[model samples]
Target: MSPLQQPGAAGPVFALVPVAFPAYLHHDALVDADREVDRIGAALAHLGASIRHWPLEPESRTEANAKARMQSWASREHDLPHSMLAWIGHGAANQDSGWLAAYDTAATIVRRGISVDTVAGPVSDEWLERSGDEGAWSIVLIQACGAGTFAKRLIANLLGKPRDPQRLILIGVGSEGAAYLGAVGDALEEMLEKGFSDNDDSITLADFAYRLRAYLGRRVGADLVVHEFAPDGGTPLRRSPVVPGGVTAPVNVYHELRAFLERQPPDVRGHFVPKAQGAELSELAWYFVGRSRERGRVAGWLKDTACGMLVVTGGAGSGKSALLGNVVVHSNTRLRDLLVDAGFIVALPDAEQPPPEVFDGVIHLAGMTTADLVRRLAEVAGINPAARAAADLDALVKALSERTLTVLLDAMDEAQEPAVIAGSVLRRIAALPAVRVVVGTRPSVHDPQRRNPVTELLDALGAGPTTSVLWVPRDTEATEEYVRLRLNGARKAGRLRATATAVADAAATVAGNGEFLFARLAVHEILARPRILAPKQAKALAELLGKDQRELFAAAVTRLSAVSATFDPLMEALALSRGRGLPRSDGIWATVATALTSGRAVTEGDIDQLLDAAAPYILLDVEDGQSVYRLSHHNFREHFESRLAASA
Candidate 1:
């Protein structure tokens, strides 16, 4: 079976909220949601998906009830990697915001969710951050009138990052008037059940995301738009059913590429494969605040094979790793354009999921020397490494000339045999055909340190590019920008619960400090909750940054659990979610949390207390109408998971 059709890592999306329209909520769906839900369910079943469904009444549609049901559903083990959550119902959207009308929105009841208004959307602040974990397939699909029009901004607010968070793909319909929601479900089911029956063709969610709009326009005669947001900043990697003027390739190209990549085996241990993930592409796209000129110079030089070799040397903790990572991601994007112009195809193998965009092949060398790196990389290029290992590094690279290689050699000083590897090995490899190398290492700040391995390696290589990164200057500017960026994004996501002035003041304080990690820690702690800070709050946050990285991390954790009783439970759940982020586990955590909270007999009230408190810390997202919760950051999951495991 094609990998696209393989079972999701986190099982299948739970298709909840089976009702088309509740009797209450003072609203109704534009289409028959029940019929639409059933259609998608049958399609999923045909595709061999493992999913769960929730049964609830319209009166039970309060935020609290929905939260509880989602928690119960997620607590079970499906032995899958990732999940998708979809909601098909009536939706309201305006220039300011968008929301799915929940049962709580009845005319007789008060609105529970809203940013500026008394009411808000059911989807939570950490929705994007938590719903998706690394290497899992997660999607949030919403179908409602005006959802298509308001989705771009509304989803940005809900998910925080437009791009797939690690693996989560956020998609929605932006509507003009009435939406043909049922048609969307029908199309998805039809195409999926067919399961790329055409050996020469396969589909990615990206294709689906863009194609949905076309489907609505054609089948329903409804004008609509779709957005496939990526983490490479707020700009969506928007796909259209057709590229207005772009070249069309043979349909078979899709299946051929998918089959080629899927059939390849994972790199064996000892021997290695360059991970397509990392090089901080998406993170850089977002957090990279400055050094546009430097990034351009390096990107341009790398694109030109003549200046294939360059070392970006910097002091420890100066953001060298951060800089190099962004370069590769951006460079690849630039290269993709170049390749497309040259009649070469560049694509994301996992679609929607951002792995390295490859033009032939891209490799990053975090560790490994000239010869060993070449031999191993050759294997990835389908070159028989056993046959080529005996040859010199130059000859081995030449054997793989058909494939273009962008080699990122990060932190070379940390690698074994740094001097020999960087000097002779890297120089020779860089000189080879279709190969470009970018290396990172510690700067030689002192004369005696000139004997530093990197210094010696440069001398040996001779006639190459070397740029020293002034950490303080670069990071200082970037920090302030990052603070502004984060805070702004938080406000958009409806997570920033502080006055604008207060949040700005806190950001200024952190930015002025000029230390990268500490600022991040401070922001994650102070802003993680209400998404903002006040004068006193800003001062407390600034102080919490601590003397160093260690103290800062400790401070961050202290804040995580300081005021919230639900923090520990949420952390445990996040850790247990296996990195797909935690789904709300109303059933699993209630009794366990009650037993742990006080060593005394506890009632359901205690569980309620904890769960209620967790509401703020955990993000609530919906898939197929289930309200799921996830931790705001992976570090929180790691920190709490470690604590839980230790206690156990």
Candidate 2:
């Protein structure tokens, strides 16, 4: 079999081909040409690359010799998955084309010692276009003057070819820019070291380009140009000799989790309450307070050697997800302090003991299947998700056995198959050695005639010594604090025309039942119409305060009906979306809205106005570079669907 079809290859293979010319016939010689080549070659070799330097002898640096050597190297390494070509020498460019000066390049070529001929021995842009395989990832690094012009011509050439799956990246200095010898090499080495220390298995070319540009800008204040063709995400340059443990630090995965959560809408993730739209996961830390006792319980669970799993059960919107999100986003120091304060692990001198283990993996189960969960876990664990062996659950469990880590799985009740996830998936994962599992979900309801999914899940887990359940109760104080904070901000912003005493009274009454979801909706209603705070509207405020989540949603819909004629159709469209929200771009929202409204000629402007009127009930987010809209809460969708059913 060919190398491209080779089975069981561990990772991508990298090949480095460098060529440098120090002496030119008519141009000034480069004294550090060989040194520049050596520096770059060393950096690439550190990443496990096979290096091939052209022109073994200084006398053979002519254009004919260089072309032959490059052609031979390409013939041998064409099937390799990744290759980089580095050119360090003088470059000349005109308006339309560019060329690299070879050792024998001259202003005028003299043939037979008498006849003056055209310039010869200069490698033109066409030579580059004819070299290298288009099927493999090809990276070109040019460190010569006018390299940017050469890169532009090469980019234009490749743009005319048929696009391939692999990418071609050209990183070069500006057209008239000059680069100091060893600068590129030093920057690359530093970037690799930092990435490895952070537990990155591979460095993407995009990231490398950014780092290189920043480094050069700070050091020499020069602009580095980069051109990419047939781009397919970020192409990673694999590190040589993988880390021995095959385990990623929890902090790295925590960073990934934070990024994942930020990309999701606040309501879908249940990490944010109402009126805090567009708040990132990092900002949620400010709103996280009064969960000390629950955090202590979690810490104790983590410290317990015998307990393998801790299930956190609470009613809807009782702060289960927010607590978990807080834990995931905490800094290393803060997480360590939480464990030390909870008495789970004692603080010691930095030299005396290593820091305690924080959460290593966190996955939200909404819309995730068994395969999706497995893939996510494998990725966070530093395992190759595409490997055939990773597809099997047992194989994955064995792979994870090599590392000691804790993972948090949130919103189990929201999963596509909650029973399979909680029973089979979580059970197997929790059974692994040195692995701790934390799960968050709603309380199980008992059903005599039908099989209760949560009950079955709990039964599957059993009341074993390794299993523990922590019930989440209403936090009246925390709810009150949240209310006070939000209302005070509204009052300051002139959105609420209530006095300090009135605000305090409203906070107390709203948080009296300790229902966080209800309080959030109630505050939203009050803010929507500040006139409700008037003396004559006391009964209206009292009525609003007395309503539950369903009643509040119904009232909001009634108010929306007075605001927009398309409110019912809009709610129906969002309800029909379920987990996969509707994109607001490319006429998708218009098409769906028009269809739902029985061909009422819905326009983009109408959709925008309706969305504005129904902002509280809507969750707007960006998915795959497009704006998406969904009902803010699953309960809200259920209410809409139930209303539709009753009317039917």
TM-score for candidate 1: 0.41
1-648 per-residue lDDT for model 1 (tens digits):
221332222333333323233444566423355566666655554333444554665566655565554343343233444344555555566666655555556442212232222111333322333454433344455565655644566555545534424333455554645656667665654344221222212234454444444334445543354545442222111111111111111122222222333443322111111133232121323345666555655555554443256667654445666566555544455433433453433332321212234223333332334565556456555677565566466666566455566656655653446667766666766666666666666543123223543446455544634322222233566777777777776777787777667666667777766455455556556655573365546455556643454455545546546765654554465446543332222233344444455444333233334434433234322221222334433334445655667888
Where is model 1 more than 4 Å wrong at Cα?
1-287, 303-308, 332-376, 379-382, 385-405, 411-428, 431-434, 441-473, 559-648
Tell me, by TM-score, which candidate is best: 2
CA lDDT, every prediction? 0.46, 0.59
lDDT of 1 at 249: 14
Which ten-residue region of model 2 has the weakest summed lDDT?
A: 112-121
- On a 0 to 100 scale, what is the lDDT of residue 35 in model 1? 65
RMSD of each: 19.6, 13.8
lDDT of 1 at 634: 34
